[model samples]
Structure formats: structure tokens, C-alpha cells
Target: MKLNLNKKYANHTFHIDSYDSTSIQLHNLASLTLLLELTPRAEQLRRIIIDKVPPTFRATLPKLIGTKGKPILRRLNIVQQRAVLKAIAANEFFLIKGMPGTGIVL
Candidate 1:
């Protein structure tokens, strides 16, 4: 794959001409390969991290997540209720995982 740099390197302090051709080309190729390999994982992890954070951190998120609304006590089982409350109050990331039938709401 041909990796074309979008920015003008001449504008930056470091000029492309300073590096030897072979090393610069190899570095670009390695960078392109590393970026392609990690891009999806990085994006996925970003969404996961953002989602796990408290809704209060983002103004729009609370509305989307329905934090302002009254809790539907009947809809949630004991475990589900606890999980939901904990998720709302949690300062850090948390993942709720379970097998089928065991409600894991996060």
C-alpha cells in the first residue's frame, strides 16, 4: 500500500531532506503498517472507554442515556437495578458481562 502523507513536511521544523532516503522510506512503511493494524482497535477502545465513563462527563450523553428520567423499577430485576445504579455513579470504567438469561445491563 502506498502511504501518502497529507501534510507538507517543509512547514515543520524537521525536513524530510534531513533523513537518508532508505531509512525515511522504511520508517514510513513501518508506520503505515502499524497504523493500519492498530486503527480499528484504537477506535473500538476509544468508544468503549467513552461509553464506560459517567454520563455527567458529556452533556449530550445524559440525554441519550436517559439519565434525567425516573428509573423504571419494575423493568429492572434486582441485579440489573444494582448494575444500572453502579454504572451511573461509577467514577471509572466497568464492564457488565454474563451468560444468557442473566441480565448484564451497562
Candidate 2:
């Protein structure tokens, strides 16, 4: 992404450095957003942290056990994945239950 603060005429030109959104990052961001969306206002001010992410995990879960990208968590059950996501969203969720450290949140 690039921005030009130059004042020029209609014949002027400009160039951007470079930028693009990766699917992995997009997926991660989307998942995080969903977590927030799931959280309610009452729990908004607490300290929360995501502890773990399971291997061979479902993309859009709380809805299903197996899934993938694009609308990742869309077709799954919103109920199950709700609490964890909600708590995180509220910023009151903490101490992830089963994270073995690396390979989680990727």
C-alpha cells in the first residue's frame, strides 16, 4: 500500500510500493473478528487470552468438526465456538485449555 502527498497536475503520475492481503492472515483476522463478534458487551473489559488452537481443527467451528477457508467459520455451529470466541472478544477470556505451544493460531 502506498500514498502520495504530492500536489500535481492531471498529467502527473505516482507509484505504490506494494501490498496484498494473504489468505492465512485474512483467515486469522476473520477468526479473531468472529471471536469479538461472538462476545457480549458485559464481558468487554476483562483481560483475556487465547491459549490454544487444535491441529486438524475445523475452520468455522462450533458448527462443524471439519472445514476449510473462505467463509471459514460460516457453515459451522455458532453455539459451541461462541463462548471461547465471546470471552476473547470481551477481552475477559484467558488461559487457553489445550495449547501445546507452537502450531496453534496459524
Candidate 3:
């Protein structure tokens, strides 16, 4: 199977080829493998698991935070923002979960 992906955060685009398999599970695995290979976060996860080191966490959300010079019209809610800051300071991994349309992005 061939998959084309555009990086949402960067100006890059590429195609990945995953060989067809008889089972859907195999195809899903192939796609997941491709994703792991493409994302740097996967490497962080690996280091966390193998080397027992804290993962370096970074997040970029245009709607939540402004760019280098420009200012944002709105900012993330104070509570959520504080939580994220605390997690990063503590080197903790946090999972933000919310229902659809809650404007939560993670």
C-alpha cells in the first residue's frame, strides 16, 4: 500500500510505501510502522523506554500559541495552560482528553 502524507507542522510532503498483505491487521501494522518512522516523538518514546531518560517535550499549536512575532487573538484557558506548563516542568507525560468540539487539541 502506498500512502501520501503532508506534514501539518512543517513544509514537507512525502510518500511511504507499505507492501500489501493478506490480512487487514498486517496492513494496519505497516501503516503504524510508517508513522513511527516518520514522527520524532516515536524516537522520544523509544528512548524513554530503552534509556530511562525523560522525553523532551515540545508542542506547537497556532491556535493556542502565537508565532514568533505575531500575537494571538485568544490564548488557551488558564487552567489548561497551567497544567501543561506544570507537566513540562515536571517532565511528566500527560494525556489531554475531551469530547469532540471542545476545542482541546493534543
Which number leads on lDDT? 1
TM-score of each: 0.30, 0.20, 0.28
lDDT of 1 by residue, 1-106 (tens): 9665556554557455465688888897875565456577645445555455333322233553455434674576778766766666554455578863385755
- Compose the digit string of candidate 3's lDDT tens values, residues 2-90: 55444453676545753455587687787567556747876766666657775445564443333432332235566555544545544
Cα TM-score of candidate 2: 0.20
Instruction: Give candidate 3's total backbone clashes.
Output: 0
Candidate 2: tens digits of C-alpha lDDT, residues 38-73: 466423422233434322323344433333322644
How many Å off is the CA of 55 in candidate 3? 2.7
